[model samples]
Target chain A: MSVKLTDDVGAALVAAIVARSPYRRALTPMIGEITRIALANNQIRAALADVAIRSNFEATRTLGRRDLGPQRATLMSFLEYVYFASPAFLASVGEGPKEGSHNGH
Target chain B: MAIEADHCDVAIVGTGAGGGIIAHRLAKAGLKVVSLEQGGRLPDDYFSETAPPGAKLDFGIGPSTVWPADPHDSLFVHPLFADGAHGATPRPADGFRHFQILKLNGLQNLWNGVSVRFCEADFAGWPFGYDHLADDYSQVERLITVCGTKEGIAELPDGEFIPPKPLRPADTMIVNAVKSLREPFSHAIPNRKAIITTPGLANSCISTGICTSGCPVGAVYKFSARLLPEIAGLDNYELRTNAKVTRVLREPGAETVSGVEYIDTKTGERRRLEARFVVLAAGAIETPRILFNSADDADPAGLANRTDRVGQGLQDNPKSVLSTSLLKLWGHKRTYDIGYGDLLILMSRGKLPDGSDFPFIGHAIHGLPDVPHYLSGFAGFPPAVKIRMARMMFHSYVTLGLFCAGEARPENRIRPGSTTDSDGVPQVTIDFTTPPAAREQMASMLKWGRKILRKASATKIYESIDNNGTGIHYAGTTAISDDPSAGVVDRDLRCHGLDNLYVCDGGVIPNLPDKHLTLSIMALSNRLGRHLEERVQSETKVAA
Candidate 1:
């Protein structure tokens, strides 16, 4: 979590999540897909908790073979969303997301 | 051997928004003013020959930008320090925090051309009241020739204007959405921007659309360009380009500043220039760097650093950017240039999830132009998806960039580096820690930015997960206070113990909200000019 300014990969990943507005739009639909897939497959839901989110995104290409529907690209979007927009980041800042924190500045 | 000294009535350093306005006011008062700038002055036609952003960087200080100023250097630098190379200081001891320095001369032209005023509530920790600053704001408005419509918002006060840029198709949709929303669903209005529409003192904005790169014509108001012509005409004023000031000299026994020492960048000659007074307007980071580097036997810790607050209280609005398309504008498929002031301003207070009021957030919504056609050719996209992505480019996507008012903490600061710069002056390292209050604001802006975009019929909304503080509205550091223990500068913006020294920049601002700070810095500099005028006349009378 002690990311320095020079860490290009970390910075790019974070910027892709926050500054890129449509990416959050990438979230709502993807999360819905995640919910639907998790309800049907016990193994995928378990992997979300046990396997690292990065590893899960890589694992998604093979998710195409599963009976659970969604184009491979849509599945990739879901994995990317879960990896970047995770609630775990608030832990680094030492606070959970406060309600109504998105008020005007 | 004695160093040669050229004496002046007043000496000013730096020529950004703060220094330029001070020079304008003082020179107009007929006092002899000598101004020094580290970067070479851009010729009036510089933008015409070179692209606006690169004209100066080809020869001088480069901005890794505070905004989308050029296609080459597109994204705003994460912390405003991304491009540092020559004698660049290492990261600070507390490197994880927020801090960066963007001191480019005439760089204000690259801003969103915003002209916002801080409200009465935003000045809570300040020694003075909003009423006192109200008049100065008016004075600065007229000087800069700001143009905007008055909405009568208390937090975002009305200002002197020449009529704001009319809303584009996308902005109109957002405004219509705001009108339909529930009570204070964060209202939207045209931004009070420094860009002029009708010609008078400065040339009017021609709506050429590519302003952030530096206006090729005389439209956007950069303090350097606006006042340089008049200041040049003044017989008592002189502006020296490429003069890198290293330190403010204090006599071995004296409490006041004796003069300034600088190097002539062109000639590499070291020189001393003495004056009755010196103003450190190099900006918050460099201003403190100068003070800290002036550590001689007479003042070991640093000049005017008795309170240990010289480089403390560093700040910038905790910023967030979200992208979305306009509902009606996208249906129309209209092309936009984004050549006007901020399309809309968002202002409101929110009650947080933690059962407490969140720190205020203000947003400036600028219409994004067409997605660069070149992006359509990226080979990485699937051939089938390329067609869809190209069609999506027609959407009138807008970026709602939010700036949050954060409380200053002692841990947020910039300090002199272990080594010297190319000019032989110490470079600086920045460190910042968002206090709990400011952290609350960070959360507030992100949450609200997403909601507002969604309500406005936004599609493909991307909320920044890490991007914060690309805006250069920095403040604090040599903060003003009536009590020395509370800050480094006094109520009048004078250095606490150094009688002949003063600081006029964002550095003296004790409290900063998300409001744009350039106009306010200009107002404060004007006030400082009048104070110095009075003091000079009194001294003249005593001498007579």
Candidate 2:
């Protein structure tokens, strides 16, 4: 089924996923904007749907989790989309002490 | 109509790895040099780290706004692969799709800068061996400012290098683990990369872990960033961007190439530039395509294809990726400074058909920013569970990339298609298949890689074998050989039948070693420059 990700739905998905992340404060504000831009690519959109279906299969068989169905896939797909597309989110979570200078140079 | 001839000594096509070095060397030696680059110069902020919201990002490097929307749009020759299951239907794969980068600096701008020299064994079938090009290799090393530790491994030779960047904790663990293994499998060394590590020469690598998207600070070696500035001020050197060379122009009834015909990409105007000599460094695929496209009634096959070997013997390193999670580093805080380039070189010795020791090389990469994407794909968990798993396992991720030496076979070749692109250049049809022996070697390498990772306390190992063309280190299209029947070029890189046509790109490489091919291409170009300089001086003396 074709799921149109409007700004409100994308924002809701972003809010839900960021709530579970450690960098919730940093990612919550910017992730929706990033996701909206990424979803513009038809290739990425198709890939998201493919990943969602495969994720559902893995969850049901391997993890023994109840099939949360399309809603669950939608939420997981949005999370996957943001994870791959949003470098800002990656940078926020990966922030750490920069090595002052490499090899004492 | 053809434009008026401009005075030029040497006209080089493609301002990439080979062309860039050749232009710099020839220009510095006081010879007039002109380089034609298909793509124009990128903007100053092309590699900037910040992007406006709603901009597309690639691998944590900011907005890819400067890059073409489709990577194939930059290529002069688009490659069609015959990789269908039945092996008859030709289609595009991830490998050839991203193979050629047509920007001013070419693929060098997007390279991860893993600069390792081919070992002595790698020169088995070449007209010249390692010792012949040793000085050239050292010169290119110093020019590019390669960073590594000289471990004196015979299979993986050491080069002139700055101090290597320190290995991260995960890399250190893997290195120590390899130390406990048996001979041949036990050796691991810091990767020798072309990235600048010295403080004063240029901006040093800040370990942003985004080298592939173009180094924002110019720490990584790029022709436009490093060598172009050196030659831009020379009065004898000229670089014409947005000039797409169509073919090498042969002088009537002569065995020498006189000049080149190109299209002004900005205006769609056909132009000709005459020169004393012409060098084709457009790349392995496009170089041969240009030669084939230049075929006429005199040389119906191609200019240098008298032996029908211009596009034969094409090869690319067959690669496999093994991803694993370091059990020891799980739940550790993630750091962005983990080197995006190969952190360490893992060499395993194997036996060739002649019972000679062949070095099988693999690179260990740690803390890639894209780890979470891989995790989210296969984890099969709920959204919250997947997020938590990504957070916890982020620091534990380690990917081992293995590249086997590709054997140059006559069957695996590139031929010009009947149709042409919008610019009137022929599309390329690549008929490449992984040889059975190479496939066996890749399988063996993958198995051995899993063992090494297991030794390093890695869990949940996964292997992904890439399609043949993905290695991107294309070579041996126009191979070098002493016998005219066997190869396209001579030891001096001059085409066997053509007096003034030279090939200084990866096309002249006789074989593909496991290591990256850029540095070797640069070294060959440097050697060619010195040879041409001496020849030009001798000719001038005879004329005087």
Candidate 3:
């Protein structure tokens, strides 16, 4: 089964992931791939997401204040990073550049 | 993939001092001119006379600021300056938005409003000297609304100007020291600088001490808003923003550039433009990058890189700061102590063992602006302590000794690298270093500054000093020569191997002598504009 992803779904999934685990460098690629596969596979998408959310929620309860500040900035940074890094944004913008940006250096 | 060429009599790149001066001159001469600027045009309201709270990102903090370049490529960015080698891909700056070739985040970087002219001996190695460029310099000075005075020094050129802004008490003390040291055996003059009170921003009119953050009032000349207005009404001129030239297209069987290909920065569209003559005022780094990227498949070494000098011999004016001791002033507190003063000018006085006298550039002892006051106030200093600090500052002086915004040997140089962006345009490798002589001069100047201040009877003096900020002047690499085997462009500024192409920016100064680079750059652009006019007129006659 294939599951279709929407903007809200992507945002919620990212938020849920952050709400669960603090920034583990290892988690980025894992979440990215899992999200991609979930979007591709319809049948297990919602179920897997629900399970991931439950586990992530449990994980968040164990995180302390010491990890919050950087985690938030990093998450904000990651969201911004993801937005620009999205294939959709890149596709619409294409690879061609605008003027006043060339430096050759 | 759509490529269309728009033709013109002359096409100039960039729109700062170099491009703006050239446009004004060429358009005045009745030639149709096209100026391609990568940055978007700012409306009349773009500049705020009020103080800006933070860094303004035209592109992005760095390479990230520019759209369409590889998001990964942050080596080259606008408002260029010296940081590390532009060739070195830097790790992301913490919390900073992006990376760039040069780091110019500071308000006191680059020329920093120093507009002194090149000295004669300083021009010995240059193709022409003050006499050659005098008339043109005057013309450009008028166009830019320069403020300066004639010092009658051989190494320094004088120009038309407003009345000299008098030095503050602190600056006066140091100036007295340098002058007092003069005698038949000594005869040394304090170095000179051009400092003006910007009238644009506020009623600080008594002495609009703001110079670095850009004159809130248009007292000092900034190219975009100040000088361009003089040439705004010319119908023959067209300024195109966001048109980034990717490559220069040459004639099928000739070295002549027929036109250029560019990317539309906003729409991300590819396009082309044609011109009979092209003046590249895209500044030191970008100018050469354009040449490097213009290398056609048939000519891989690059269009103007035959000598490989297209990206060699890069140099920034080497500089060091000298500070004086602080003196206690016994007087009522006044706002004058915390004001910026005029940049004084003088010549080099030392004779080399070989009988050659190196030009000694002079900077006025600038008074401390109100920054410390605000900082101290913020830190909760008592009013009495703040007044005492201001009083001591009133007697302090800092004469920036001239060690040659001096030229450096090209061996201490940077290069253009091969990492092309998504557009296939290569990147620049900007590397530079300070010479031993420059360093020694810095030490000596600091010692001298202290003595000078001591002469004013200072009770205390800070031992530590500033380095006049990182040497921001960038040049060389694509120097002008008649032969393709020597420099990138010919003496006419035409690319040696490619006709109809020219670079008229600071990058052509093979070795920048100790002088403010902007004034010379403006003069050179004026010269290029005149040369272009002559070329176009001759071509029209030939056609007739």
The lDDT values for all models are: 0.62, 0.71, 0.53
Model 3: per-residue Cα lDDT over A15-41, one tens digit each: 454454433343455465435533443
Tens digits of lDDT, candidate 1, B1-544: 1122388778899887788888888888988888887667666765544433321222111322211123223434322332344323443343533333333353564565677888887788889878888888899889888887888778778889887666676677666655665656367777677777774444666554445556656677776667877878677888877777888998864878888988888899988889889998987777888888877887787888877888888887766666665554443433343445255777655556678764454544543232231231233675345334434443456676666665577877767667666656677777765566655666677777667667677766655532223455667989999899999888788998889999988888987776778888888888888889999999899999
What are the chain A TM-scores of the candidates, in order?
A: 0.28, 0.35, 0.32
The window of 10 residues in a row where model 2 chain B has the poorest summed lDDT is: B73-82
- Model 2 agreement with the true structure over B180-212: per-residue lDDT tens digits: 775754578888888886656547776655455
Better of 1 and 3 by lDDT: 1
**Alpha carbon deviation, residue B103, candidate 1 (Å):** 7.7
Model 2, runs deviating above 4 Å: A1-28, A44-75, A83-105, B1-5, B49-98, B200-202, B334-337, B350-357
TM-score of 3: 0.68
